[model samples]
Target chain A: MGGSFTVNHLIYLLQGMMWTVVLSALAFALGGVAGFGVMLMRTARTRLLRQISFVYVQLIQGTPLLIVLFVVYFGLGVVGIELPPLLAAGVSLMVYSSAFLGEIWRGCVEAVPRTQWEASECLALTRWQTLVDVILPQAARIATPPTVGFLVQVMKSTSLASVVGFVELTRAAQVVNNSLFTPFLVFGIAGVLYFALCYPLSRWSRSLERKLNVGRRQAA
Target chain B: MKYNFDFASLQEYWPEFLRGALMTLEMTVIACVFGLVIGVLCAIGRRGKRKWLATLCGAYVEIVRNTPYLIQIFFIFFGLASAGLKLPIFAAAVLTMVFNVGAYTAEIVRAGMDTIHPGQIEAAEALGLSTPQIYWDVILRPSLERVYPSLSGQFVLMMLSSSVTSQISAEELTGVANSVQSESFRSFETFIVVAVLYFGMAMMLKFAFHLFGQAIFPRRRRLGTPL
Candidate 1:
C-alpha cells in the first residue's frame, strides 16, 4: 500500500463529491430539455411521432445505463472523435434520464382532466396554446414530486460514471482504497457522503408526494 | 472518418455471450428469490410492535436506498476480502444484489401491506385463524398480489442493474462485453450487441413475470383485479 488514509484523501473525496453534483446537474438540465421534446412527441396528435418516441423510451429504459455509457464513450471514439470523459458521461446520463422523465411527464400530462383540454379547445385556443397555457400548468404540479424523486436516482447514478474513468466520488473512493487498502473505511465515508447528498432530496420528494395527495384528497 | 463496423469478428464469441447471459439470469433469479424473503421479513419487522426493530429496518432501507449499488458492491466485495473472507465474484455479486434489492423490496412490500384494512385483520382474528395463517393468507398474499406489478418492475430493474457487477469482473453479460471488446478492438460493436441482448433479456423477463403473476394470483385472473 502507498500509505494510510489521510486528511488529503478526505479533501480529494470532497472535491469528487462536487463533481458528482455537477454531473447530476448537467444530466438533469440536458435530460429535461430532451425529455420535454419526448413528452411532446409522446402526447402529440401525430401517431408516427408517438410511436417513434415510444420505441425510443422503451429502448433506453430496457437497456442498462452502464451499457449506454459504454456505447457513448466508445461509439464516439469509433468515429475517430475523441471526447472527454465528462462529456461522454453527461451525454449518456442525459439519454438515460430523458426516457424516464419523458414517461413521468407523460403520466402527469395525461392526469390533467380531459375536460380542460375540451374547454381550451372550446375557447378557440390553438393546440399549442391549450397545452402551454392550460394543460402544462396542471401537469407541472403533478410532476414535481416524481421529478424530484427521480433526481435522487440521477444523483446516485452519477457514481457509475466512475467506470468510464471519470474521477467522481465513487472513483475517488476507489483511488483512496487502492493506496490505503482500507476498503471499509474509504467506501464507508464515500457512502456517507452520497447519503448526505441524496437523503435530503429523498425526504423532500416524500413530503411533496404527501402534500400533493393531501391536496388531491381535499379537492375530491 | 471512415469506421466500418466489423461484427463478423464477434460471431465466434456467441457462446461466451450465451454463457454470460445465462449467468446473469441465474444471479437475478437467486437474488430475486432471496431478496423477496428478506424484504418480507424486514417489512414484518418494520410493522411489528418493537420500536428498535422498526428503526433498524427503516435505517437499512434508507441507507441502501441512498447509496449507489456500485459503491455497495465495492464495499461488500472488497471489504469482505480484506476481512480474510474471500468469496467468488458471482457469490459476492449475488450477495450485494440481495442486500440492495432487499431494502427496496421491503419498502414496496410495506407500502402494499399498509393498504390492507385493519378491520380485515380483526375479522381474521375473529375467525380464529392462527398468527401465521393470518399473515400468510390474509395479510401477505393479498399485499403481494396488489404490489406484484411494482415488485416485477423492481426485479427487472435489478436485472439491468446487475450490469454493475461487471466492474468486479463477474463475467456477466457486461463483463463478457468488456473482454470481447478489448480482444476484438471493436468496442462500439461489442457494446451495441450487448445492449440488444440486454433489451431482449428485459423484455423476456417482463413477459415471464406477467405469466408468473397470472399463474399465482387466481383472483387477478378471475376478477380482473388484485384482491
Candidate 2:
C-alpha cells in the first residue's frame, strides 16, 4: 500500500488481459462451431436428437460455469490424466459457451419466418439445403446481437477460470492484491478493466437488437 | 495409467453437504425476494420523470451489470470494512447478491413495464383510480406477470452464482466442499459431488420458480400461455 502502482504491475495486468482476450476468442471460435452443430440438432427432424440436444443445453445451462471449470480441471486429473490449466479451462469454457450460444442461435433461427421454410419447400429443396441456403442467412442477421451479448458473458465468465488456478485477469488481480494488500484498489482496477472489455459489447448488442427490431417492423 | 478413485471419503460429508445446500438456497431466495423489490423500485425510478434520477438509476444498472459479481462481492465485503462498517460474510454476501441482482432485475422489470400499453394506464385513470392503485393494478402486476419467466430465470442464475460467494468463505456448498477437500485430500471427488449437488439445486430452483409463477400468475396457468 505504501508504494505507488508501477509500470511493471500494469504490464503484468496487461499481459493477463491479453490472455483473457485470447481465451475469449478461443472459446468463441470453438463454441461457435460446436453451437452450430447443437443448433442443427436442436431443430433436427429427429425428435430424439432434439430432445437430447435440448437436454444437453439444459444440463450445461443449469450448472454454474465455475463448477464446470472445477470438474474439468480437477476431475480429469482423478483419471490419471494431467493437463495444463489453460487447456482445461479453455475446453470447459468452450463447452459451456456452446450450449448458451446454441440456445441463442436456435432462437434466432426460429425467429426467421415460417414462409421462408415453406418457400424453400415449394422449391423442392432438401431440409439441409433449405436451412443452408434460405434460413441461415436470415438467422445470421438476427443472431449477431445475442452473439455479441453472449461474448460479454463469456468474457465475464472466464474470470471463473481464476478459481481453478488459471492466471487470467482476475487471478492476476488476486495475486497483486496479496502482494500489495490492496483488496479494494486491485479488485477495483480489475473490475474496471472487465467493465472496459464488456460495456462496449453490451451497448453494441443492445443497439443491434433495436436495429433488427426496426428492420423487422419496416419489413412487416 | 491406472488410477483409483474413491467417492467414499466424500460420502460421509453428506450432512455438511445438506447444510451447505440449504444455505445456498436460503441465500438465493432471500436475495431474490429483496432484490426483486429493489429492482422494481429502481425500474420505476428510472421511468419517473426526473432526468437526473433516471440518469443515476441508469448508471447504477450499467455499472452493476458490467462488472463481475466476484468484484462486487469484494467491493461490498472489503469496501465496507474500510469504511468502518464491518459486516459478517453471510450478510455481506447477501447484500452483494441483492445489489447485483437488483440492478439486473431492474432492467428486466423495466423491459416488462415498457410493454404495458398506454391504454391500460389511461383506462385506470379514467376509472378514477389513485396513482398508487393504478400503479399496483395496471402497471406493476401486469408487468411482473409478463416478465415472470425472465425474473425467475434470473433468480435461478443468482442461486448458481451464489457459489462464487464461497470464494470469500461464506460457508455455502462450494465453501464446504473446499474445506472438505482440503481435509480429506479428495479435491476432485469433493468438487464432483458438489457439482452434482449444484446441478440438482439448479433443477430444483427451476421447478420451484415454475410453481411460484403458477401460483402468482394464476391466469397464466389457466390460459396456458403468456399474454
Candidate 3:
C-alpha cells in the first residue's frame, strides 16, 4: 500500500496490453473463420441451414458476453475439461465475435446486388464458384471498415478476460491499483492505453466509409 | 467422464434471482431515463453553434465510446472513492450506465436529427412557434420517433450489460447467480438459468418498446412503414 505508481507498474501494464492484443488477434482469427461458416450457413440455399444459423446467432447475441465468459470458464470447470484462463477467455470471445461478425458479414454479402448473383448464374458458374469469385470479392470492400471496427471491440472486450484471471490490460491495472492504492491513476492510464489502441481504428473505419461512399456517390 | 447435474439444489434461491432480475430492470429503467435526458442535451450541444460546448460534448462521447465499460465502472465505483467522492454501489452502477448509454444515444439521436429536412424547422418557426416549441415539436419529437428502434435496441443491450454491475456486488442477476452457484455448487446450472432469464428479459423489453413505439408514433403504425 505504500508503494507509489512507478515505471514498474507502467511496464507491467504494457505487457498486459500486449496480451490484450494477442487475445484479440487470436479471437479475431478463429472467430473470422467460424463467422465465415456462420455467414455461409445463414445465406445457404437450404432453409434448415439458414434457420439453424439464425437461431445460433440469436442465442449468442441475446445473452451477455460476460455470461458467455462465465459459462466457458467457471461453468465448464465443473466438467472434466480443465481450461487455462487464456484458453477459456479466447474461446468465449471467439464464440461471441463469431456471432457478431457473421451477422455483419451477412449484411455485407446480401448488399451485393441481386443482379450480380443472377449474372453469375447465367454464366453457368456453380453456386460455390459464383460466391467465391463474384459475391465475396465485392462484399469484402463493404466489410473492411466494420471488420476493423469489430477488431477494436474485440480488444476492448478482452478487458473482461481479467475476470477469468487473465492478465490483460484491465486486469493488470486492477492488480497495480490493488498494490499502489491509486485506482484513478491506474485505471485512467489504462483508459488512455485503450484509447490509443481503439481511436485509430475508429477513425480508420469512419474514413473508410467516407471514402467508399464517396466513390459510389461519384459513380452514381 | 460422467458428471451429475443438479439444478434442483438451487430452487431455494428463487427469491435471490428474482430480486436480482428486478434490480437489473430497475437500474436499466433509471439509466434509460437519465441517459436520454443527457443524450438529448449532448446531441443538441454537439450540433449547436457554440464551439466549446460542442467540443466538450464531443470529447465526452468519444472518451466513453473508446474505453471499455468494465474499466469505466471500476473507475467510477472504486476510482472516485479514492478521491473521497464515495457513492453507493447502486448509485455508481446507475451513474456509469447513464454516462455510458448517453454517449451512444447521442450519436443515434444525432443521426436522426441530421435526417430531418431543414425546411421543417423554418416552417415551424413561421407558424408562430417559439424556440422551445419549435425544438420540441419540429426537432426532438420527429428525431426521437425516427430513431426509436435503434434507441430501443441500444437500451436492450444496456440491460444485458447491467450484468457487469454484479462485479461490484450490486446483486444484479449475474451477482445472484454467482452467489447461488457458490452456495449450491451447481455453477453451470446457475448460469444456464441466468442466461435464459437474460434472454427472456431482452425479448420482453423489445416487445414493450414496440408497443410503446406504436402508441407514440401512430403515424408510422397507421402507414405500415418501418421507422
Candidate 4:
C-alpha cells in the first residue's frame, strides 16, 4: 500500500543481477569443458562413439530445461545428497548446456570440410595433432557467432534456476512483487534489464552472421 | 546408494494429469496457429515496400527474441494486472506464447521467404496472376513448403517452452506435476513421469506436423518429397 517501489528494491535487483552473471559464467565454463569431450566423441573415428554422442544430443535436445532442473534438484535429494540450491542449479545447467554446446561444436568441426581432413591425413599428422592444429582453428571462426548466440540462451535460461529457489533476477522480481504488490513496475524493470543484457549480444550475433555470410559469398 | 522410488501416490492424480496435458496441447496449438499468422505478416512487413513498417516489425522481433519467456510471461500476466486489465490465466498464458513465438516464427519465415527466387514471382506475373494470387501461389505457399521442416522444429520448441506457463500456475502439465509431487512427496518420480510425458508430446507434435504438411501440400505428398 505504501511506496512499494523503493531504492532498496533496486539494490536488491542489482544483487540478483550479480548472481545471474555468476551462474551464467559457471554454466559456460563447466558446459564448455564437458561439451569439448562430447564434440570430440562426436567426431572420433569410431562409429560407436559418434552414435553414443548423437544419442546424448537427441536426449537433451528433446527435453525441456525446466525438467532437467527439477530432476537434478529433486532427484539428487532422493539419493541422499542434500545440496544447496546453487550447487544443484549449477550442475543441472552444466549438463543442459553441454548437450547443446556439443551439437553446436560438432557442426563447427564438420564444417571444416572433408578436404581439410584428408590433407591433414596426407601430412601423416596424428589424429590428435590434426584436430588440435588445423581443424579447431578453422572451426573456431565459424563457431564464434553461434557460440555467442548460445550464450544469450544460456543467460536467459538462468531464469529457470530461480525455480529451484536460486534467487536470480526473475526470482528477485517475484519476491519483490510479493512484497510490493506492484507487479508491473517490478517485472517491467526486470524485463528491461534482461533486454539490456541480451539485445547487444543478439546484435553482435546478427552482425557476425552477416559477416560470415559475406565471407562465404566471397569464397564462392 | 540404496533407494526406494514409488510412483503409486501419483496414480490417483490421473485426472489432473490428463487435464493438464490437454490444456498444454490446447495452449500450444492456439499459440502456433496465431503465432504463424503474426510471423508471416511480420515477415511480409519486413520485406514489403515501407521502411517504417520493416523497422517496426524488426524491433518487435528483436525485443521478443532477446528476452526470456519467463520474463515475457510475467510482464503479460502480472504487468497487465497492475494496469487493471486482468485476463484469465489461460488467456494470459496463450497471449504470451503467441507474442513470444511470433517473433521467432517471423525470423524463420523471413528466411523461407528469402529463398524464393525472383524468377518465380516474375513467372507468376507473366501468367497474368493478380498480386494477391501471385503472393499466394508463387511466394507464400512455396516458401512455406520449403521451410516447413524448420517451422515444425520451431513448433516443437514452442511446445517444450510451454512448460514455463506452469510458473504462473496455469493448469498445464508441469503445473499439475508440481501439485502431484507436493501432495505425494514423490517429487523425483513425478518429474520423471512428466518428463517422459513431455517427450511423448514432442514426438506426437512432430508426427502431427508431418501429417499436416502432407495434407496441406498435396503435390509434395504425391511426389513423396518435401518442398
Candidate 5:
C-alpha cells in the first residue's frame, strides 16, 4: 500500500514545506535582531564590546551548524529544560544566522565611506544620530542584496533542522522515502521543491547586485 | 537544578576522536584538490564558445547552488544503494563534497577570471600564445591568485559541512561525538569538546592558507595585501 508515491504524500510534503518557510522566517527575524546588536557591538566605541563580539562571531562561525543544533537541543535537555524540536531548531538557526548576518552587516556598515562618518561628526551629531541619519541609510542599500542572498542560504539550511526531528521538507522526504522506497523520486521531488523556493531569491540577489554595481558606476 | 559534568569516562575515546578528525581533514583535502580542478574546468567551459557546454555547466552550477547539500548527499548515497550499486560511506561523502564545492568554486573562479582584462588576453594572442598557453599563463594563474582567499574560505566551510556526512554514519568527528555522547550520556560535554576541536581546525586551516598564499603569490606578498 505504501510502495507508490501518492497525492497524499504530496499533500504531506506541502504541509512540511509550510513549516520550512515558517522556520526560515522565524530564524531570519530573530537572527536579524540579535545580529544587529552583534554588529553594533563589533563596531562600537568600547574596545571590550568589540572584542567580545569579535570572539563570539569567530567561535560561532568556526563550528558547524549541525553541532550547534545538537548543542542547543541536548544542552537544554541537560539543564532540565526540554524544548520541542521546532524551538530547538529555531534557537540554533538563530545563533548560526546571527553570526553570519552580523558579519555581513558589519561589512556593509564599514563600506560607508570614512568621510561620511567624519562629516557626521563634524556636524556635531551624536553617534546614534549619525548612525540613524547618515550611515544606516547608505548601509541599508548595500545590505539588501546580501541579506536577500543570505535568506536563500537560510532557507536551504533549514533542511538541516530535519536532523533534530523537525518534520520539515527534508525530513518529510525521508519519511516518504521510508514508506515508498524510492530515494530518487522522493528526494528529487524534495530537491525540486527547494529549488522552486530558492531559485527566485538567488536570481533576485544577483539582479540586485548588478543594479547596485550599475548605480555605483553611474554615481561615479 | 544542578548537573555535574564528567569527561573522565570519555577520555578513553581520544584515539577514536583523533582518527575521526584525521578522516575529516583527509576528506576536506581530497575534496578541495579535486573540486578546484573540476571548478576550473567548468569555469572554462562556461566561457567557452561551445553553447551546449556552457549551458551544461551553467545548469550544473545553478542546480547545485540552489539545492541543499543534505538532499544531494541523500540522493547519491541512498539512490545508489537503491540501485544496488552501493558505495562506501567515505567515498559517497567525498563525492558529495566535491560536487557541492565544485559549483561554488566555479563561481568564485569565474568572478576572478572576469576581472582579467580582455586586452591582456588579446596581448597574449598577439604574442602568438596558443589557447592552452594563454589560459594557463594569462588567465588561470592570476585568477586563482586573486581568488585564493575566497577559495580557502570555501574550503574551510567545506570542512565544517563535512560534519553532515555523519548522517550516513561516516565516522567523522561529528559522528564520533554523536556516538560518544550517546554512550556516555554526556551530550553537552561531548559537543563542547567537538566544537573546540572544529574551531581549532578552522583556525589552523586559515593560518595554513595565509602562509600558502605568501608562498605562491610573491607579488601580493611584496605588496603586503590581497588583490
Candidate 6:
C-alpha cells in the first residue's frame, strides 16, 4: 500500500503547513482592517450605526464558520463569481474573524474610561481627533493579548479550507492517510504541528494578559 | 448570470431538515452534560493537592485547547479506529465534542473559581464544613453559578461548532445538508437554507440554555440577578 508514510509525505505536510500559515496571515490582515471599520461603526455616535454593526456581528457570529464558507464558496458561484479554493477560504475566514475581532476590539474601546474622551474634547479636539489620537491608542494596548490569541483561532480555522479542497496540513494528512491507511500517524503529526503553531501564540497571549497591569482602570 | 433558487422543491426535504436539526440538538445536549461533568472534575483536579493529577489535567487541557476540533475528530474517528478502538460514528463525533468542550469549560470554570474571594472560603471554613462539603457548598457551587452565563454561552457555541462532526458522516444538520444537496443538485439553495436553519438552531440553543439556567440556579430566580 505504497509503503508507509515516507519523507516525501512529511515534506508535503510541511508544504501544507506553509500554506496554513499563509492563509492565517491573509485572514488576520484582511480581517483586522475590516474589523477596525466594524469597531468604529459599533462605537459610533449614532445609535443606528451601532445597531447595524451589532446585527452584522450577530449574524456572522450566530452562523457557523462552515456555513459561512459554504455560502461564500458556493453562494458566490451562483452569482457567476467563481472563487478558487484558496480565495474562497481566505474570503470566508476573513468574514468570520472580522466579526470576532470587531467584537473584541469594541470591548477594548469601551473599556477606555469616559473621562479620557471628555478630557480630549475639553482640550478642543474633535471627536475623530480624540478617537484617532487619544482613545484608539489606549484601546490598542488592551487589545494586544486577545488579538494575538485570536490569531491561533485564525490558524486553526484555516483547517476548514481543506473541506473545500484546499490542501492545508489537515487535507494533506487526509490524503496521506487514505493511501497508507495510517490515520493515526498522519493525523497525529498534523495535530502536533498545529499545536506547535498555536501553543506559542496562546502562551504569549496569556503572558500579555498578565503583563498588562490594568489596575489603573480595573479600579475604575 | 441567471440562477434560480428552488427552495420550493426543498419542501419535500422539510422532514430531512427537521430530523437533522433534532439530531444536532440531541448531540449538543448529550455533549453539554458530559462535557460539563468532565470539565468540573478537571477543574477541581487542577486545584486539588495531587501533584500528578493536576499535571495530567493541565496537559489534557492544553492539548485539547490547542488543537483544532477538525483534527481532533479525525484523530478519534479514524485514528483510534485504526488502533482498533472503533466506536459508532455518532459516538465518535460526540466524544470529540465532549473532549474539546471539556478543556474549554475547564479553563472558564477555573477562572470562575479564581474569582471567589479567599474571604468567602474562610467564612465557610469557620462554619465547620468538611473538605467535600466546602467544595460543594462554598467553592464549586458559587463558581459554577458565577460562570453560568459564560458556561451556557459556551454550550451554545458547542452547538454551532458541532457542525464539524458532519465530517465523520454523522447524521447531523450539516451532514443532512450534504446529502440533500447531492440529491437535489441545488447546492446553493440547499446550503443557504441549511445555513439559516443552523442560525435558527443556534438561537434556539442559546434560548434553551438561558431557560435551563434560570430553572437550575434557584438563587437567580429568587434574587433576580447573577450570583
Give me the runs in candidate 4 sitting further than 4 Å from their true place.
Answer: B122-128, B218-227
- Misplaced by over 4 Å in model 5 are B221-227
Judge candidate 2 at residue A42 and give its lDDT: 96
Query: Cα lDDT of all candidates, in order?
Result: 0.96, 0.88, 0.91, 0.89, 0.93, 0.90
Clashes of each: 0, 0, 0, 0, 0, 0
Indicate whether candidate 1 or candidate 4 has the larger lDDT: 1
Measured by lDDT, the strongest candidate is 1
Ranking by DockQ: 1, 5, 6, 3, 4, 2
Per-residue lDDT of candidate 3, residues B76-135 (tens digit)? 888889989989889999999999999999988888888778888888878889988877
What TM-score does chain B get in every candidate?
0.96, 0.95, 0.95, 0.94, 0.96, 0.94
2 against 4, candidate with superior lDDT: 4
lDDT of 6 by residue, B27-120 (tens): 9999999999999999999999999999999999999888889999998899888889989888898999999999999998998888777888
> What DockQ class does candidate 5 belong to?
high
Q: Least accurate stretch of 10 residues (summed lDDT) in model 5 chain A?
A: A1-10
Candidate 4 chain A, which ten residues in sequence have the lowest lDDT sum? A1-10
Total residue pair clashes for candidate 5: 0
User: In candidate 2, what are the lDDT values of residues B3-37, reduced to their tens digit?
Assistant: 67789877789999999999999999899999999
Instruction: Return the clash pairs for model 2, or none.
Output: none
Residue A37 error, candidate 4, Å: 1.8
lDDT, candidate 4, A86-125, per-residue tens: 8898898898889999989999999988999899999999
Q: Model 4 - which docking category? A: medium
Which of candidates 4 and 6 is the stronger one according to TM-score? 6
Here, model 1's chain A TM-score works out at 0.99
Better model by lDDT, 4 or 6? 6
lDDT of 2 by residue, A16-90 (tens): 888888888988999999999999999898999999999999888888787888788878887877878888888
Q: For model 5, how does the per-residue alpha-carbon lDDT over B1-227 read when each residue is reduced to its tens digit?
A: 69888878789889989999999999999999999999999999999999999999999999999999999999888999999988988999999999999999999999989988899999999999999999999999988888888899999999999999999999999999989988888899899889999999999999999999989987763222433
Better of 3 and 5 by lDDT: 5
Per-residue lDDT, model 2, residue B139, is 94
Model 3 C-alpha lDDT per residue in residues A87-164, reported as the tens digit of each score: 999999999999999999999999999999999999999999999999999999999989988988898888889998
